[model samples]
Target: MSRIRIGAGRVTAEIDEQGAELCSLRYGTEGQPGATELLWQAERAWPWHAPLLFPVIGRMNGDRLRHDGTYYAMPKHGFARDRRFTVARHDATTAVLALRDDAASRRLFPFPFRLTVGYAVEGSRLTVSYSVHNPGPGTLPASLGVHPGFRWPLPGATDKRGHTVLFERPEPAPVRRVEDVLLLPERHPTPVRGRTLRLDGALFTDGAVILEALNSSSLIYSAPGSPRMTLSWHGFQQLALWSPPEADLLCLEPWYGLPSPIGSDGEYAASPGQFHLAAGRSRTFGFGVEVSPAR
Candidate 1:
């Protein structure tokens, strides 16, 4: 397993080859230390730091996908996070990892594609970018997303609920929830009150809070006198917030796709939030996070 480190100013990040995942992000300088942890440590509650979801996001109904006339079984969130990525480039404050389709991937996706993930640090902000290239002669249908779990209480909150998420703008519309832990073809009332949603484990009883049509591209996770983190994304169509009520973490996810809908045609291409790319074409998506020092 290979891991690369990148840093600039007060921000430092560690990326792992196993998943091309950002395993650690620390803020502040050395000496008179005032270090802060911005990313969760993979634990038994959920053994993932920040897993990049590619080819597919969330689960396919019955773990199956129908393309053309045949049905193929696919694992939840596809397989990119479990595969090792080759380090294509690395420097003091930047790194890039690449994953290419092979026989193994073809069995699941049946398309020739390449996924490149880049990480860079500047001051207290870190930017993550993804590029998807369709190299085959046919259209490529796929999804991509970023799932990063931050410490629930942050750096100074007294309790998890003491922390809250502030949207850049108010979301007055109802949201959707997964049924029985599976995606449903309906929308439900959102738990957010105007622009702020307080953090609490009980709020996840029905799973993640999935919001679409977000008018804002930025979000703030913070608590009184605590280190505040801002997550900004562009070109993402949806967002999902989740964490087990019993766990001390909160996931702020930016997604281009969601789980396969229930009671629908099993065609993977028809899945909600799926993207299509013509042969030889490429698409790019990105998000960044800036963490301020603890108060």
Candidate 2:
């Protein structure tokens, strides 16, 4: 129940010790609110949004995947995004949570390593960071990402079209759905720009969007009709837009790997899209979002 409050005006988060933090993409300076609610409502409202979801991240091939000479089970998305963590560091504008391999974790991920998440806020910007370290005798393959949802009404709930998701470029990407995940493919290698979209509840009927070909470095989530708040993504390779059917929030996931389509990639020999690191060696993959108000 520890909260990291930002400045007097905006951006804050309520993170549990496990590095499971939620960011508030709203105005008036309050942290994000969902994990607890989601946990409480999962059975009745979101039976599919479990808090302890595990490997391979982001919709694996047909609910199964290949990894390191063995095939394992992967939930809809990855874990970590939902597990609680222990506080590693904190002050006024920043906080860090960490998780190392424990007996419980070994049940699913039998690896000896640690994962740390850091979050910092300055002015109208909040930066969330993910760093992983290997401490065991061998290397491990892993795919990690941030699944953040900012309650819409972007600018401040004043303007109906007040919030917009702008793509830097406009080349069309293939919008496809995996068994449970969504993939945003590019028409080519480059992203398009100048295209802005207002999110509606109806767009996710088939379940997720993998955005490709974007020129804009950011995707702004604003208040419905006001310019009070906006959250943007700047360095993510693939942006996924999602939410449970009845929830009032939007999940903007910046990911590094997209699982192979269902019934495909039967061997999952390594982390779906993650590389390997040998004993004493380390590899890192992460993206950040800048939160602010709409202008």
CA-only RMSD, every prediction: 1.5, 5.1
> What would the TM-scores of all predictions be?
0.96, 0.74
Residue-by-residue lDDT tens digits, candidate 2, 1-295: 4545443335444455433655333334444342112112223434322122224456765565454556555556665654677887878877777777777666456667777767776765566666667786976666665666544444246532444566545535554444456333323221223366656766666566655333445555544334433334433456667666776556666655565544456545443455555777655544444544334
Query: lDDT of all predictions, in order shown?
Result: 0.87, 0.53
Tell me the tens digit of each residue's lDDT in model 1 across 166-194: 99998777787786446876788777889
Tell me the lDDT of candidate 2: 0.53
As for candidate 1, its clashing pairs are none
* Number of the top-ranking candidate, with lDDT as the measure: 1
